[model samples]
Target chain A: MNVRKQFRAGSEFRIADHHPGDKPLSSGDKPADQLRVSGLAEQIAAFQDIFYAEHRRKLLVVLQGMDTSGKDGTVRGVFGRLDPLGVRSVAFKAPSTDEREHDFLWRVHEQVPAMGQLVIFNRSHYEDVLVPVVHGDINEPECERRYRHIREFERMLCETGTVLVKFFLHISRDEQKRRLEARLQEGDKHWKVDLNDLKERRYWDAYQERYERAIRETDTDPAPWYVIPADSKTHRNLAIASVMIDVLQDMKLSYPPPNPEYFKIKVE
Target chain B: MNVRKQFRAGSEFRIADHHPGDKPLSSGDKPADQLRVSGLAEQIAAFQDIFYAEHRRKLLVVLQGMDTSGKDGTVRGVFGRLDPLGVRSVAFKAPSTDEREHDFLWRVHEQVPAMGQLVIFNRSHYEDVLVPVVHGDINEPECERRYRHIREFERMLCETGTVLVKFFLHISRDEQKRRLEARLQEGDKHWKVDLNDLKERRYWDAYQERYERAIRETDTDPAPWYVIPADSKTHRNLAIASVMIDVLQDMKLSYPPPNPEYFKIKVE
Candidate 1:
């Protein structure tokens, strides 16, 4: 079952073509599917140990989504099983004043995976395309150029050894309303609710348009995007976990062969 | 039971006075003790949500030890439950050329936790006092100066609202020999067997002495040190998790009160 191929974003990808309510990956039994996700997480951990030992290949997982989408939840559920010492999950927020001085990629480039590392960008360089474009900060010409730069930058990363897995957690407008309203009503979750998220909701369709265009333009073979059906949190984790395991298994990860010299050495 | 105070390193502290094999924090049943660690890990996770919601306190956990003292395992065990988005565990390896150009603390200072974060230093600035000092890179007077700087730096961090929990994972020389022998013999573990770790083993006594002196010198109340007995891997995790929960509890963590204005806002 080529799970990644089924969901991979292509140049012709459209947000409307996908339904947030769909759960192609689910078994229809919610609890059972969640258990399967936990099982997949364990498999990922096993491979992660061997992957770290291989120490030659790099992996970068990019998660892009609208406000209230489960980007943070995906990281916590799937990648959380990997050794914290090895898996670095970086959540990119609004750029700091210092970061604003540099090109968008400058700060992002500083955080890419090195050899034997697995890095997760909670919200990534894709935000440059999503947020600014929705706000009309960049003209269409500039947006296209940024897309080209992204394509070239990602291509370079893939050519250099990074295996990129990008995801757009797709959720519907009504789901966002339910989530936002819940946050407003729930005190414990208020910290997570940036008031700006509600203000930004006014441009939901615009953001969706920008997201669809960005995904279409920058979608490449080496670094393709996966539009995950994220309306159901369990299904989202299940699908993303399935995709992650698929990618890692594709890498054919293994431990390095033992060295003869190491056996000859004595610890004393 | 003031677990931290019982294990705290003070000016009179000496590694010779402690036994790495001790399991004071354990239940004496390996399975039960391991289960307790898991339970404590869950508790830490629960507290973590409220702590993140509180969004005002910072936690910096520094883990330092000899090779195979279980710093990595402790991370995988205790801190693994933390949301990757909220917790960052930094494993400081040998400095790069660019890093060496700056002062020792430069790289470390840049990685400290911000409010609402928990940052773990797998190995940290203390390496400067341990490795370099063990190799005769600095004299006694210079070493004392570094200790003073460390104390002052930690004081400032605590004063600025960062709570520090530093651990010295104490493993016996014999245990390390056994672990190293196993690593050398196992094909799967070879990747983690850095030849430099073997070479440094020759300076075991010297490194221990420096660790003691450094811990004693800088073990101020603002940033006290807890000497964790790590020969028993389960006990090491159990103790660290216990201390972590203790510290987080002391903070009196709670979700911020519901904003009255938030109740009035309509998501649609």
Candidate 2:
């Protein structure tokens, strides 16, 4: 289904479909999704090995979302089964004084994964558009130029063998509020919730406006964005996991043939 | 056992002792010390969970080694078991044009792990000391200044709650030659071994001398270095896994309990 087509129909952009998988909301007992999860996990792992062995292609995954939209949780739940060696995740936060002194993409460009590796941008280059657009850090003319540069940058990545997959975890304001409060009430979790988060909450409407526009403008062929419904964390995990599997399977990777002369190594 | 104290005694630097109660080089299907491996694996997994849950103490794992020293294999074997969401790996290459324009540490500092996460520097801050010190990128007086700055920077990291674990994957030159040849003979493995690797191989002796001095000088009380033998990949994984478990377990942590009482307001 064309998820983005549906998203453009109205001003209020949100996730419409929830996953039909049987992953239960409560953590008590999960009835064997391991077979499904493990199958996909093994496939992803195998694909990663081929990418490394062949040293041919690159892949990038960009995950952008509001707080409690399951960026971290979805990553944990989906890629949990793969080997960490070939996979790299870069989480971008507020720019440091030194970073702010340079171009926005300077810090990000440094973290892009090497050839034959998968790079995940957690709240990635999109921030150049979203955060600055909402906070009015740059004028409209400058914002337009920055957005153009981002598109070209990603296009260059795609040309250089990067198969980019971008996901935007869509959550409602109400769901976010409930999750934020939960973080505050939990024993050790209070540390995760900052009072500054409340300030960001106030800018929700402005951020949403900026997000939708950026999605509309930058959702090109090589780097399309998928908006996943993340209200129910379980459903969100299963859906994203399925999407990730579909991408790797499409890549048509296989484990390199086991060397027939492997026994030649005399273990001393 | 006081591993650091043992490290101080030059004679105790034997690679075999890392296996402790087992024949480390054995090729049996069953690990030489099954009980120890299982116990250590479980402890490592649990401690990583607490470290992940804490959402406060950031971790920096610096992996430095000689050519064919099992750096890639160790990351794959040990961290392969970690929850991928909570970890990020950054591999440092020879500095680019823009990177060289700045101080050596400038590029590395940008990649430091954020709060509530684990960041592995496949080669780290010590590169400023080791590479330049060996390659003549700087003079003795300037190199000494960098050595002090690195110590101070690491001390700062610890003060700011970033737990640092530095591992030196130690392997004999003969073993390295064997592994490199293995890569060449294997069907798809040849891509990882480039001509530059052979060029770099010529400097092994100089690299080792520099490493010996750096380890002795910078191995501090707060961030002591662990020199794991890479002759056997299994032993390297097992030893590093055990040390990581010890560190994370020392930092007590708990899950962020959900607020069952919060009512979810439906936005219609």
Candidate 3:
């Protein structure tokens, strides 16, 4: 199956129905999958060079997932090969006091990709819906209103030449427990092991339900969502890389033609 | 001579006294210098990983130069290896109507690096000094006042844990003209060629004078300026990268110590 179509969320999609451990895009060999990921990274870099030089379109990749679902790993493994000049990765932590002074989307909007740039949102506006809905900060009607706002905003982005790719890194409860424990066991990884992650794990089922709702509400054809099985880190990277490369390829990106007049000019 | 000391602007520094085409950091071999640049890029990346993990310090790199002095190229070559998650490259263009309404530094203050992140300002608040002075929009008194404002603002940033590195990419007039002509001849590169760049080029001498004054007035120990000879693109990249690596090394960055208790935790 085409990776783009394989993992795309359908109208009736249920987060519970997808197996988080599945490796549909992998070659069934860990080393080979890792090698393939490296190849895809290089190809993505090449495409990014042209995309940047063309200097017309914008690309935004949003990663949303449960705690320990590998958002940071995906950034390093999948998008690490590209030059920093043309790519921006924004990790939205809790909003600052100043950011809270504005609307939820204000900070997100400020960081959107400009012409010929690609921006990856390590976490994104979807947090507005997910966190508020899960915590009962906003009721269903208000949640639905924000969904409409998001849809309108994304539609506007699309009309203005931004290409959107959203991903939900799906990891199972057991997998999360194992990952959390591993972080606890690895002394070197302690900095990343936030106590809040553990506190949030207690609300896992609520998060899952809210994530499903968020994905369903905002997953339009123009800004589709892909749910990647992220239990195995290698498979997670492979799937995201495959989906990203597919999206870039479908854009049919090409460099602008060289100028004939350029050939006549000589550096003095 | 150490690359850092070699390029650091002196109390008696005169921009005209520096040769824009000098390659003090290079091996006198183009390909060898290119390879060294790649090596420096990787080392910078490794240091950045630790810096990001340390999560306590802030880094701000400011690139200021004449038109076509390679601000964008410096970004790509020197900082390309960093994980996009931790680095932000902000290209400040002409102010929008809204930005112009606020104090000049208002927008700039909002974009400073938070703890454990690196931000590159392609052109920065220094523009506030250069453009107005060159165009006679501000009188000498106004320019001097703004310089004082900049110094106080920078001192505050340094005190608040931000380590600032400023680079003035020095390019000769003949080199600028050659670059402009090259851009004009290349149809593919036309998108990057702006009529305004040509117009700004007309203010070359004035801009140079203003730049010198800006650097002189603003160059303090905490936020010292390095005047890079930028005619040779390879040398420019090397010098910038060398100075940057030196700065990071001097920072003595190290990863947080491993947690002993983490090894005692077990997954459920």
Candidate 4:
């Protein structure tokens, strides 16, 4: 199956349309699927080396999901093998005092990848649209305005040679409850367990509706969103890796040609 | 020898006191020195992985030098082996309109490395002081004020879990002339040969004097500056890699302990 086409968010995309438990990218054997993820991750790392050497194009991967939806795990599994020098994972928390002084996109714009870079945003400007809309901090018209701003901002990044990939890790409500319970039960994970996550869980349906609207309104050819079925961690990783590999392969990345003149001249 | 102590800028530090051609770190064998640099680079990469996992400390490597002093080359040689995910090289060119609207350090402060990140500044806030002083755009008092600001800014970073290592790649005027000439002669290098560099070369002595004053005024215990002899590319690489390895070793970086509870829990 063409995983990219299968997961690509369209205008008609509904958060409920896709089953979170589906394992479209997985083979029948679980261990084999896990092995496939590892192999693809290594290949992505190799491609990243050339991508850094080429030093021409930029790639930005935006990951947005509900809490306990495996954003961090996806980073560790899919992108962890890549060299830290060229790839950066920026996790956005709530805006600080200084961040609130500027427009919402101010901090986000400052962290975009430069030439020969691939940066993954653990959460992104999408949060600005979702949280506010769900809380009624911004009305529907204001939320729509912010979506327009995001589309324009992304289009600008694309025009300036950035390849954008947005992923929404889709997890079922029951899966979230299980993950949250695991956080509570595990002593080591107690540190990561926030009462706020449970509080946020109360706004589940509102968040889902906001996410669907945000993804639908801003989904463009230049920066398409991918909704990954994330209940199965292994399948989520495999599917995201597959989509990234396809995107990078289509980029036709190659290192800048060796300088012929530079070869002849010896460093004195 | 304490490599860090040997290169640390002092109150009496003068740019002319250090010879750009001196290879204090070299062992007299040229090829062997190059090999040593490669080895050090690998060791530093390994330390970086642990440092990243530790996620406690921050490292800031600031590169400052005149034109053709090998700032870019130093990044490629000493920092190239690092994983791109943990390391970032931010090249600060002339300020844009938006940047000019803010205080000089505004754009800079926004780019400081987060926890577990190592950031290299190609040309940093130092530029704010240097170019203005050299061109008489800012008077001596203004320059001194900017130096005070830098000292405080760096101190703030140091206090906040950041280990600062600033390098001034010291290359002689004659060596710079040779490099510029080679850039002009080589077809492959023509793209990198900026005409502005030639124009800036006219203010060579002024720039050197300003750099000396900047280094002397800002050098402190927490954030020390290293004067690197950069005439010999291989020696320059070796000296820098050695300094960096020494600094990172001093940091005593280690991964966060494995979570015992996490170890026991199997993913369902």
Candidate 5:
């Protein structure tokens, strides 16, 4: 089956219908899956050069999920191999005083890719709707307005020279608990510890409900959102790399024709 | 009558229904009308100071019309007296080579007002839809797509803390002919004359049809389109300034509260 059709978060999607452990794209061999992901990452790097040289359209990859849902892992495993000059990674933390003074999207709009660039938002404007609504900082009507704003903003980006791919990294609650315990026990993982993440886990159900609503609201053509079963980190990377390969293949990216002017010039 | 209600080009609007020579905002005295326009300009200036000092929201004013429809004149007469720090006017004559390489809205998006500023587009992205459609450079489907892009783009801007007021300056063919003749016969007006504008007059009917369609498609609550009957330049100025006053007044512009901490500060 086409990976996009399999994982697409369409209007009819229900969050409960997807199982986190389902490895539709994986074979039984763990090393083979990782190897496949590496191969796909290389293909993406190859496409990025031509895409950058074409210099006509842009690409924006938005990764959104719970803290242990492997957003950072997917970035390193899938997009890390691309030419650094043409690719950018932005990890949105809490808004600064200056950013908070403006609308929520002011900082987001600043980081969207220009032509011929691929921008990965480790966490994006999606966090605005999710964290604020889940915490009750934004009420229902205001949340609805933000949803509308996001839909319109993304549609504009897609229409005006950008291809957008949004992923909802879906990991089960049990998997998150197991990962949290692993982090608690491992001394090396102390750097990744955040009391807020542990506190946020208390609102797991609320986050799930909000994430489902956000995905459904923004699951649109020209900018489709994919829900990836992300319990297994290797499979999560595999699934995302597959989606990127499919997206780049669909774009038909190619270098511009050899410049006619080049033939007329000679080295001094 | 409320200026917005009087001139708003909402659903069920027809260009033929609005007479170009109509002076709905006029007092039937030319010098008195001119004085009222000047008074309104001053009101705009006053409102602008508070609006700028409020330092929260942004404003975008779009003026679009046929050549010699008083677009430049309206900018000078209505917006000229405002604080230059907060007001920036952009005249988009033709897209440069770099601009053409990207989408139509790229240049326009870069010029959008940041927080607390008012930006005016003398001729905006609307021209992309208008000129291309009327000149047969764009077919129906492509024109429709451009309109959708524009609607989504403007809707996003409005939702992101920018107040949008779009005006289509309406002028009769006879008025255009008179203006063109004056530009031809007068020495001072020669600098403003463009032979392309004369050539474009041949497609006046096509242009009108496209304009009506564009207005109807984009007339929304957040970004309202006000049709200004621009036969009399002074009345045109009066109507636009009146609308701006209404919009700014609606926003309830005021400076931020005085900082209480100022009481403890002293200079050596």
Candidate 6:
């Protein structure tokens, strides 16, 4: 039997579902293509130490994943090593009445980082296509318009020196179910689980189809999507952090040489 | 010397530097008004626990202060207790060309939180009055217009269920000097301090005068300013964290009730 067939037929097989285009590098016996742990941690540590004098490029890390894929934990564990001064994290939820009155992208456009800052978006502009398509909140024609808007938006950011990194934490339905049930049994974690999440889980396959289409449609040169296998939480985090550090280190930021005027204490 | 003598001098009193009717809580041996540490820890823990479940009220925390007045440290220390899941941090710096083209508050208004989330502003809307007035970027007439605009902007946020808590980390010039020197001498810290900070220090008295006027003019019933003395870093962090906990506790946030409809199994 192939390695994919070695797992329990019904349970573990479903928990380790692999996407069509996933090409993960191997470590040993385990299919590190689905997850790699140790390599990721070492890469994250090295990036954290190479602090640039000035953050020259703005990085927008957009994380989109189903519940229990460790979005919160990824933020805390992976980015936790970074200097807070350079990082700004924003989680976009449902729009407020005031926000709804404006264009859907108005609020998001405002949160983009200035030069020298890193902004993380937990569930971002893709919602315009994903949610509206799923719920019929927007029509197919309207969704097409949104895809173009997103491409233009990302291109504008890149042209202005913003480096956008988008990630879809790809977890198998079985893994999600296992994690959700675990939350219910864990006393302290009960508050983290919601009935709505379970409802959404029933539509998991449909959502996956939508996600695959969205990735195919909107994965532009500037803001490409990296579909990460998130069944192994540690490996998923290390992968995302490794990518972030690599991009930042490539920027070669240096603090602007102190202006000569800064040295002149004036008599005025 | 009297307990208040530290703030007063021959013919010039530090308190007198304040604008008319701008006297903040007097700063003489008045012990830091702090929230109970254990209570604060508990509140933050509870916030983290229930944070994933959706709620209705959004919160905006504004931290405005002089250089080295504990803005960064307070955020790192106080919010360090809360789960980062529900809280977003925004740090605003000097404006860029696109930002400058719009009205001063245009960029800031876009980044306010959505319902049930908490947003922290490292330096907030008050920068309109603080920075522009000091640099003479706007004349008196323009400055007054901005002050009024800022008040209205904040008022709208309060009306829309955003609990706005603005804190001014008030500290003495001597204390600021001490901290800035420490940053320079500390090996790891040396890179973070910039020469521009020293230039801004020279204009300390003018900025303080501008801040006094802004606070007295705009401190409203809905969103009031808490001018906490920030000479002692530990006390400042404790005080700010306590206030945040107290505010959230007063709001009585809870997880959204489970909806069975949202949990129904779907026929794919």
Best by lDDT: 5
In the predicted model 6, the residue pairs found to clash are A24-A33
How do the residues A1-268 of candidate 3 rate in per-residue lDDT, one tens digit apiece? 7998999996678987899999887788899999999999999999999999998788999999998999999999999999999999999999996665334665787778877889999999899898878889888987887787677667667755789999999999999999999999999999999999899888899999989988998899999999999999999999999999999999999999999999999999
What is the Cα-based lDDT of residue A240 in candidate 6?
72
Each prediction's DockQ against the real complex: 0.01, 0.01, 0.01, 0.03, 0.26, 0.05
Runs off by more than 4 Å, candidate 2? A1-268, B2-42, B256-268
RMSD to the hidden true structure, all candidates: 19.1, 20.1, 18.7, 17.8, 4.2, 17.6
Which candidate, 2 or 4, has the higher TM-score?
4
Write the residue-wise lDDT of candidate 1 on A1-268 in tens digits.
6999889989999889999989998889999998999999999988899988888878999999999889989998887789876789999999996555334665676777777889999998889888888888877887886786677667656755789999999999999999999998999999988989989999998999999999999899999999999999999999999999999999998889999999999899
Docking class of 4: incorrect
Q: Model 6: per-residue lDDT, tens digit, A138-235?
A: 77777776665566556656755677778778887788989999999999999898889988887777677777677767777677676677787666
Order of quality (TM-score)? 5, 4, 3, 1, 2, 6
User: Which model scores highest in TM-score?
Assistant: 5
lDDT of 5 by residue, B119-203 (tens): 9999999999899898888799888888888887788788678999999999999999999999999999899999999999999
Q: Please state the error at residue A21 of candidate 2 in Å.
A: 71
iRMS of candidate 2, Å: 12.8
Please write out the lDDT profile of model 4 over residues B1-268, one tens digit for every residue. 8998888888789887899999888899999999999999999999999998897878999999988899999899889999999899999999987565334666787888877889999999999988988888888887876776677667656754688999999998999999999999999999989999999999999999988999999999898899999999999999899999998888888888888899889899
Where does the lowest 10-residue lDDT sum fall in candidate 5 chain A?
A: A97-106
Question: What's each prediction's TM-score?
Answer: 0.52, 0.47, 0.52, 0.53, 0.83, 0.46
Tens digits of per-residue lDDT, candidate 6, B1-268, equal 2212222122222434433222233333334333344446566767756744655777788999888888888777677566777788899998877676444665787878776677789997688788888998778877776666666666656755678888878888888888889999998998879889999999988998887788877777677776666777655655666666666666776788887887897879
Clashes of 2: 0
lDDT of each: 0.87, 0.69, 0.89, 0.88, 0.90, 0.68
Ranking by lDDT: 5, 3, 4, 1, 2, 6
Native-to-model Cα distance after best TM-score fit, residue A201 in candidate 4, in Å: 0.9
DockQ of candidate 5 (2 decimals): 0.26
The candidate that wins on DockQ is 5
Model 3 chain A: ten consecutive residues of lowest lDDT: A97-106
